[model samples]
Target: MPFPSRPVAKPQLRAHSKYPSIPSPSATYLVPNTSDPVGASLGGVRVVNEGLVGIGRLSGENVDKFGETQGAASGLYITDWAYASGQFSGKFNVLPDRGYGDGSSNYAARLHEVNFTFTPYYGTSVVPQTQVQATYVDSTKFTYQDGATVKFTTGLNPDTVGGVVGARTGSLFGQTVGLATAANGPDGAQESLLSFDAESVHLFPDGSGYVSDEYGTYIARFDATKKITGLTQLPGAAQPNRPANTPNFDSFTAPTTGRRNNQGLEGMSVTPDGARLFALLQSATVQDTNGGQQQTRNHARLFVYDIAGANRENPVAVGEYIVRLPQIDLNSDGSGLDGTAAQSEIIALGPDSFLMLPRDGNGLGKGTTVPILFKSVQLVDFASASNILGQFDNVGQAVSPAGVLTPGVNAAATAEVINMLQQDDLAKFGMNTTIPANSNTLNEKIEGMALVPDLSTEQPNDFFLFVANDNDFQSSDVKMLNAAGQVVSRGDGRLNAGITNDAMYYVWRLTIDAGAKFFRMDVADAP
Candidate 1:
């Protein structure tokens, strides 16, 4: 059967150049003629390279109509220059047997989501189920892979997996998982997820690459069935070089707990050469000893992992740095106040560096009128990241009230990272120097980021940026940016428009190829 697809209308586009360029400059765009005067202005040149090339929503006709279609639209694998759209097929089995405690069904392991497309050079993509047990309640931390359909779910300490729904197997929890016949609900009552957390897969010419998490953990390898290739509990800058036995898993020392309660890693992006890895971390602590429960502790940090060294078993953190602002309070809920967890999702811009989108906190900015100024994507040097394993004895460093930048290899090169965070850099593209009005509306959780190839220009690095926003139809604001972090494009408003901003939730992964082909599978709104 044909998979479902959604078309975006008036698809928003912003930029800093007269046209989209490779390695987009650190700038903003001009404002469009819209209803709200204080709204974001658009700038530079707006270019729509390709439109509706592929679809990335869950199966089922009326699935969750509130999510943007998940799929790739730009990047290295440009399928056709002729502008012709591409197509592919996959399966999602509906499981009815799995049930949550509240008289509702869940789509955990019995039937995970499976979907994939091809890249110009790397034929068929192969992403099997990585984390089987993760798909339990409608609310667990399950990620979608080549064979899985649930999108990447991050944040929220006690993660839940309730939305995954698909084909059912007669076995679960080590028993023969079976499917039920009834549907469940609290909010996205259907659906399920794979076994992994935030993950990135590189489809090598031979389908062999490492699939690691933020904490530098290589959970599994991607072969035919997403095989259980290797595991390193003690993952870091070092290589353990241990052979995999049955149920193999590593046990590296966590950078947190060991230190001043300062290490919690998330967001892992590998270099093109696969020699280095970059990680983003969220550190939490109470600024004032007498504040309320959630207010007393919260901090966020960024670190780098150098794999080129010899000690594989104990890879040390070679670089470290802090991206903070005086008025930027991590402890405050959306209001930029005190005592909030300043969170961020990271992605690699190139081999030399990466970018971070730090969300101030979970506050709605309703009561207090604190401007949300911590939503910019700051660029940073990969080499300059201090070794968490080496420094502070692998016992992660504390991110104090004043965010710190513990220089790594190329501290001087931080200009690129800082420029992307500048208000002027964003203004060039006609974008608001501050956070957009409803910054947190669509979960504002940017999990995956990829650059779309635009060869017509002199620079090839300036590709398009596609962020994976998890809130399905509820907040269908899958942000599109130029290489420089400008709001150049927005999700298709068609399938996502008219729906209440809260109608859906969760957009997991965002993948792109040279052919302008893309894939973005959602764990919540699969219809």
Candidate 2:
């Protein structure tokens, strides 16, 4: 919700009447369609008439005139603004879960098919940057080559079934066997071990399909040669604790690492058949190494890894699930201690069920706020993770206080005035629903999720989630359900009227290939 001012620039003294002169259009500038580097704009937001404005004028030539009117599908290309801001947020490691478009025509070469963005002071402490589009296709046309294929469905409409699309036929990231992390560290220190913002990708009942990093557990190995192939350890980190192992803690600190793969990891969910993997680390442990000036704020953790063989690399931590927050125990009790709450995102629905979106850090250094959806839903059942089945907080039975109230609101005398103003705002954010203060209205700093299935052939685990409110870009909210997590429906006109809240704004990451639904936005005008 940031771009909207276009009617102020006064000071034209001799400003004649309002009817006559109408000739002032020159402001082109869109040459970069090197003939298909992969493109598609078709046209959406091109509002420009650019007429006159004499007297104390102002027109930095309509700044590239919105890519000269998106003609010829457009694929703008230019490169090296320090290599496009050092591939900010870096992602897009290769997509084509099915619908291979990007045949390119150049409307400013699809702004390098934007893989990620939102940190130009977004929400705070920076951290939201990702971009990957170096362009190289030798062997034949579609070339991200090797065997490239990604297909998953659930965009809905007979669209196959459920979701799980993947493809990476080799060349994982900037070459050298692929996967690369460990950047920034010296002073910005978020510490990246082959970095990963939030990605889940799963299809395991044996057909094999995996991808992790809901909070940087970093596991990757789509296999069949698609490249990504390794990194997934934890059956015992090397098995030492003996006694069958269950109580041993030493490292796993920094940026808070525990729960489902610690360090405030945000959102990720996997389980159509895949053994299980749902990590959402959001905060706390932030050790911030080398520079970003000493750190550690709010500590958050939540892990549940267990992918034993055939490409899970080895992953086997089973369960940790820690996110208690009593406003971080009165801001870390001067001498008593209870501090810890960091999680960027998470979403996994099966073998234990899952859904977390913690990030109410008040926008860290300042600004980005709004995401904080933790209605207490973490169902872990990794065989030995010790069964939790339900954590519950259905967001005060689906919101009330005259705002959104659900559970089929019929107002049994306003249900005790909406349960005493939701227990007086859950005691100003320190008494329940897992605790993590910020005035608590739900929203819980979630970054992305789009599930939708439930085509109702008797409700095969029903769904519809949407989520994504990274603080701006029109805020966000959508929820419909079945399979126990009730609710049934909510906003955006009943969430885009159906096929699941359509799409728009910094979704950062969303997957459902095969059935065709690939996403990764953030391109502030490219041409």
Candidate 3:
């Protein structure tokens, strides 16, 4: 997959839409705000009466329960995409990073199709009219390099989670992993469940696409029925190289470096033509880090898969590049690591260029001592740099720094289009220097992003950028604990300092003038 070069065009941010500058410092920032337009559309997506097109949501009202989850609100780390739904018109598709259920239960491990009905503003609350759900059929069909077939997600001990369920042998292009063959998880947790920890999904026109995961950096396929049809691994992402550590794999051990644990393949996008699918590593993978801590290793590994038509059943590894993430405020010592960031969501602006969201782990404005800060959605162009596909694709390699193309690592060219950080105006909402109840920013797992069509306008270029967050199906109680029996505090330890998981969903939208202008390249398809 060859990405064409593009003339540099600087992006300008008009003005912050009239949404709430900051969520109420005293209210629960629920998702979808399904009941009314107050929260859902406030400072979010509004179909405006743009010139002659008049294709934006006007004052309107509607009643629909945005969407709901099945389990404890503690795990819905919605790291899916907001990309236009490939199945139907006027619909947008969203996926979730559903954590695999424990060995004792299967409720949390299911995959479902999430879609929303788009309606322009009329007069009342303008929220999606409907929320649809369908069970995703897991794809157990896989052909490995050694001619051995691995039935992914086959019946296995739940206790043994996050293992290399299936992978390529020596014959494949990127399976020369340099790590150990086994997986590492909790003491009793099985290190053998090679199931797909589906983190992000990108769909094609024909209703087919790839679902990426954290387990083995697996790139799996889901059919129109939302069932996983077939699956494969990134060129070098196989068992041995997929750091044995379970969960985030965030902690690396040697040649087996991979996407950090918890922070797996969180963001994925497909070109409009469905020729190339791109996936972003939430953070720098073990192989990409220059032996630095979280803040130091900011290069995000972007993988490109070249496919044909809407059905990307067999995508060839065409290109891979590095996107450097902007660092956040540091702690006094700098060693304690005060800030958090991950390349959670990404959408293609055009071929070789995409919009990515990088945010800290603090749930919105997390601390009273530190000024509240939220996530930033950014657009980057990767046209000029040489492809670093082979260097770190193998196990023994390390990702070079962002600007410098070290001997083994080749740097990718990237230019920032817009940094959402500058657009902050949360002070009015009471989320500035001091934090208060309900005082927060975007949801923590701000992962899902999609370029939805502006049905209001017949113009293809008109579209909306839909960004959503994973509530983690969280509850107000202490849901997790550390080994010493202590509560594990998240983001400044304040849970929006008070926001409840049962709170409603907040769906925001931004109008992209030519969103319909599919990012493309003039060069021939990948070889």
Q: Best by TM-score, which number?
A: 3
Runs of candidate 1 with Cα error greater than 4 angstroms are 1-196, 199-205, 208-221, 233-264, 284-303, 306-343, 361-374, 382-388, 394-443, 456-458, 472-527
Q: What local lDDT does model 1 show for residue 378?
A: 40
**lDDT by residue for model 1 (196-310), tens:** 2223432333433334432123322334343323332322222111121111111222221211111234345555544565654443322211234333333333545565535
**Per-candidate TM-score against the hidden true structure:** 0.44, 0.24, 0.60
TM-score, ranked from best to worst? 3, 1, 2
Cα lDDT tens digits, model 3, 1-527, are 33222222322323344432232211111111111111112111222211111111111011012122321111122222232322212233434343212211111123433333333222222223122222222222221222343212311122212443223222222322111122221122222233344566665546655677664566777675555555656655322343343222212233355555556677777766667788777767655555545555566678888776444667788888877665554432233442335677777655666667776554442333333343555545566545878756654355554323466443443323222222122222222223243423434455666555433323333444445555554433322222222223222212454544322222233444323444322222111
Which has the higher TM-score value, candidate number 1 or candidate number 3? Answer: 3
Candidate 3 lDDT score relative to the true structure: 0.42
Q: RMSD in angstroms, candidate 3?
A: 12.1
Q: Whole-model Cα lDDT per candidate?
A: 0.28, 0.25, 0.42
Best by lDDT: 3
Clashes in predicted model 1: 136
Candidate 2 lDDT over residue span 1-527, tens digit each: 11112232322222223211221111111211011101011111001111111001111111111221111100111111111321223222211111111111111111112233222211212121121122221110011122343211110111111231111111233221111121121122221122232233443323234444322234445443333445452222211111122211211222121222223233445544456566544442222111122122322334566764532665565564433221222222233222233433344444543334332233211223322222211112222222221221111111122222223322100000001112222333222222222222223223444333212112222222333323211112222221122222223221111211111222211111221121111123221
